[model samples]
Target chain A: MLKKTALHDAHAALGAKLVDFAGWEMPVQYRSALDEHHAVRTACGMFDVSHMQAVDFSGARTADFLRHLLANDVAKLSAPGGARYTCLLNPEGGVIDDLIVTRRDGDAFRSVVNAGTADKDIAWFQTHAAAYGVTVKQRTDLGILAVQGPQARTLVVPHLPAALRERAFALKPFTAAWEGEWYVSRTGYTGEDGFELVLPHADIVALWNALLADGAMPCGLGARDSLRLEAGMNLYGNDMDETVSPLECGLGWTVAWVPEDRAFIGRAALEKQRASPPRRMVAVMLDGRGVLRAHMPVRDAAQRDVGQLSSGGFAPTLKQSIGFARVDAQASAPFEVEIRGRWLPLKQVKAPFVRNGKALV
Target chain B: MSNVPADLKYVKSHEWVRKLADGTLVIGVTDHAQDALGDVVFVETPAAGRKLAAEESCAVVESVKAASDIYAPVAGTVLEANAALADKPELLNDAPYGEGWLWKMRADDIAAVDRLLDAAGYEAVLAAG
Candidate 1:
């Protein structure tokens, strides 16, 4: 049986089309996906990301354990409510998963990982954590709600806990604050100002109803995927996997090659590939009117294979199709994508096709 | 179940074809196919005067979820492709059988339309699988 979230019934009430995603029954869309995409871009939208796993690491040596596991230095998350986006890499420098590690109060560290890789990630964490005497506990009790877009913060604040409203508004981007079990973060996958709330399942259901009553559109995974793509955020399996490293997938910035002595798990492999990376990533927009779906082959003018689309789809805001192509490190601009055996021109552009409800590319 | 208009002949691939008085045929995806495709964003129809073989992937319909290839129901010469889809692809979702008609083609053999499934037969295809 497919696992259902606490809000599965709510999705059904909204007439959502549920599909199995990573072994969980989840809403792909409610009505029109395009409208939901637009709603998030222009106003406010909410997504039930309860399926994603939030694992808490606690122990005396939690800081030291994270430093040894993640590619990005955990030392930067020095204070409570601090957060860092990093990737868990295998010894060979390939990405196991990408996650956000938040520095919680005391000896606890809260990290949210993709739903599809949660189980495997817990196993990996358990394997590496035992040496440092850390305990890996998954927080299945929490339901994550991401309210994103221009008005996300405004629309969500009035509903926050009475005491937390002021502090929640004061939280800076990439930061989080907690009051008991209520945690609010000023971070999002969409390139928009927003709040991601982690609340108890029972509390979350109430909030969902309140938000809907107040006109916050309840979006689904369909809009979430497009919003992230437009925001230029990488999806775990689609963009990077066990086969590719951070350098090859436009995430070299996430790697901390500094401090010199931090012997992270994949440091040696990253250092080896640093001088001459085999693959590189590029952002492409179809010059013509057509959708670019994942797995489509990217080619040079001569039709020689360059790479493949990691995440590709229609950009509702731009009214054009856009995607990310993981091409050869040596590959240059003016790429072509093979669609139905036809070579369609794809123009290379700087990433983040949209941010904060504005077009960037 | 979406509307399967009895006046139109259907293909297992979910295309509905209508035989016009001039022996030309009008084609578009069925209401069921449109519902399955979600919000249509772009539709690429064949250019006028293009020739198509039976089962040829002659056009494309792109939704937010994914892109689907629209195959030709029978061998035909394209008369005119819908110009409105260029600007408003949502027509496919809003009116799959009317304003969303993909193209007009003169069939190589008008008998090809009779060979396609009627509404009841197409309903059976939906039922079996």
Candidate 2:
């Protein structure tokens, strides 16, 4: 059975088309994906991302444990209320998940992970944290809502507590703050200025309704996927998997290579792969009459099957089909995607096909 | 939801066919199909005068979310296709049963239309699913 969020009834009442996504019955779209996608790019949108797992790590060894657990050094989260974008990797240097770790205090931190990989992430943390005497607490009592877009901050600021609003307003990118019972972080998956609010599950329904009343459009997974894709964000299962390495999945920037002395779980394997990364991730925009879609074959100039599209869709802002593909690193620009036995011309380009209501492609 | 005209026939795969006075068949995706697909972005239709077999993929309808194949309801020769869909594909979502007609075919066997579900039969299929 698919689990429903607190906004289930609200979504149904608004005529949302609900689908079972990663075990959660969530809204895919209310009116149209294009409208919702445009709303997030131009104004403000809210998403009920409560299905994602949030874990609380406390005690003296919290920092030390994360240092050994993540590919990116957690020591960089030195200041309280700071946050770092990092990747949890398998022993073979393949990314298990990419997440944000927030420093709530000296010895307390919170990490939010992907919804589909929550169970596996918790298991990996529990198994590895045992040796370091660290406690991993899965905070299921909390609900997360991401309010994103250009006017996001302005829409949410009025509802925040006065003391919290000032501190949150001063938050830099990737930073977080704890005000009363709410944890507000200036971070989001969509490429927009927004906040991810973590509060008690009981408080979420009211807060979500208020956000809607405050001119924040309630978007669904359809818009969420398009916005993240146009922003060059990677989907866990689509872009990378257990067999794919971080270096090959457009996530090399998330790996911290400095302080050569501190060895994390996947350092050795990554060092070996870094010298000769196998496959490389590239972004492509369809130049002709075809929509790029996942599993479509990518061909080089010689019509050689070089790779396949991993994540793709019509970029609302660009008004074109764009996608990410794992291809031969030596492959050059201007490839072709085989859609229904026809080769459609495509141009390899730097990602972020659209951002902040503008087209970058 | 717009009305599904009683005179038209529908296929289980969501294609709608209207029989013309000249015995040709006009084909398009149903309203529910367009709604489920969200916003149409690009559409690929078969060339005029092409022969097709029943259930053959004759066109492609792509939305912002995914792409779906529009199948032929009966063996026939393509008479004409909507050229406007290439520039304004969202017409399929806006007026699926009217201006959104994808193609017209010279029906090879007129009896094939009887094999298709009527409005009520198609409605029952949707309900059963």
Candidate 3:
């Protein structure tokens, strides 16, 4: 049986096309995906992301525990509301999952991880947290909604409580504020200005409806995927997994190499791999005909195999096919992607193909 | 709930065929098929003059989520493929039957088009699914 989010009924009521995604019955599109994509880029749109799991860490040793468990330095988050994006890696330096850990109040931090990796991540946390004296609380009672776009705050702030309205409106990117039971974070995966609200599951449907009534269109996973891809953001399973490291996935910046004395989980293997990085992730834009899709082989000038696409799709904003590929670390721009027996040229860019309703290509 | 014109003939594969005044058969995917596919992005129309066998895959229609093969309802020789779709594939989603026609073909047996299912039968196929 597939799991359903708190807003599942609301999605059905809106005539959404539901699909089985990562063991959850989630809305793929409400009306038209292209229209929804435009809504986010031009105006305001919202997504029901309740399937993503949030693990709360509290107790005196919480900060110390996260310092050792994650690749990024949690100690850098001195402010109470600061959020850091990092990867949870295994001992061998492979990314188990990438998540955002936010420092909420004193000794309390919450990390939201991928829906598909929730069970495994919880297990990994429990097994490793035995010595830290931290409380691992899986927040199943909460539902998350991401409202994004240029006018997202203007559209969503009015719906919040009066006291929270100003705080949420004033929130800086990557920071969070708690208003009673609602946790509002100025963060999102779409690479647009947005707020991710985590509230009680019982209140989700009302909030969804209120947002819809207030001109926030209900977008589904299709638009979500395209928006994230256009932003050059990595999708967990598509871009990286247990076998791929953060360095190879263009997430080297997320790893904190500072506090050299502090021993992180994957530090040793990562230290070894950092010296001789084998594969490097690059942004690819298809220059010829045909859509670039995952697993497509990337060949060099001499038709020598260089790499393969990790996440590929049609960028709705650009009206062109774009993807991320794991090519040889020495590989440069002007490569070819083998599509349906044809060697088509691809233009490599410095990622972030689109941001804030503008095309960077 | 999809639009199924009574004058057209359809196949189980979701393609619809209509006989033109010149006896050439015009083919396109049904509205339901396009709706299921969602926001057609790329189309691979069959080449003109290619001979096709009944139920053979002739063209490809791709959406962001998936790619589906459009099959020939009857044996025919391709007359002309819709050239506009090479640039604007979303025409299929906007107008699946009218301007979105994939290709026109001269049927080997002109009467073979009648052997395909009618609107009611096509609706039944969608209903069963």
Winning candidate number (DockQ): 1
Residue range A50-117, candidate 1, lDDT tens digits: 99988999999999999999999889887898999999999999999999999998888999999999
Candidate 2 Cα outliers beyond 4 Å, as residue runs: B1-3, B21-24, B109-115
True contacts kept of each: 1.00, 0.88, 0.69
Mark the regions of model 1 whose C-alpha exceeds 4 Å error after superposition: B20-24
**Highest lDDT: which candidate?**
1
True contacts kept of 2: 0.88
* Model 3 ranges with Cα > 4 A deviation: none
* Per-candidate DockQ vs. reference: 0.87, 0.78, 0.74
RMSD of each: 1.7, 1.9, 1.5
Give the clashing residue pairs of candidate 2, or none: none
Give per-residue CA lDDT, model 3, range A234-324, as digits (tens).
Answer: 9999899988889999999999999897799999989998976889999989975568889999988877899999988888888889999
Residue A156 error, candidate 2, Å: 1.0
Across A1-361, the per-residue lDDT of candidate 2 in tens digits comes to 9988777888899899899989999999988888888889999999999989789998788888898889888888779988888889888988888899988877988999988999999999999888878889998888899999999988887777788888888889999987777889999988989999988877788888888888889899999999999999999899998788889999999888988977898899999989778889999898766777888999899888889998988887888888999998887767888887888888888988777777887
| Model 2 per-residue lDDT tens digits across residues B32-92 | 8998788899999999999999999989998877789999999999999999998899899
Please tell me how candidate 2 rates in CAPRI terms: medium
Could you give the DockQ of candidate 2? 0.78
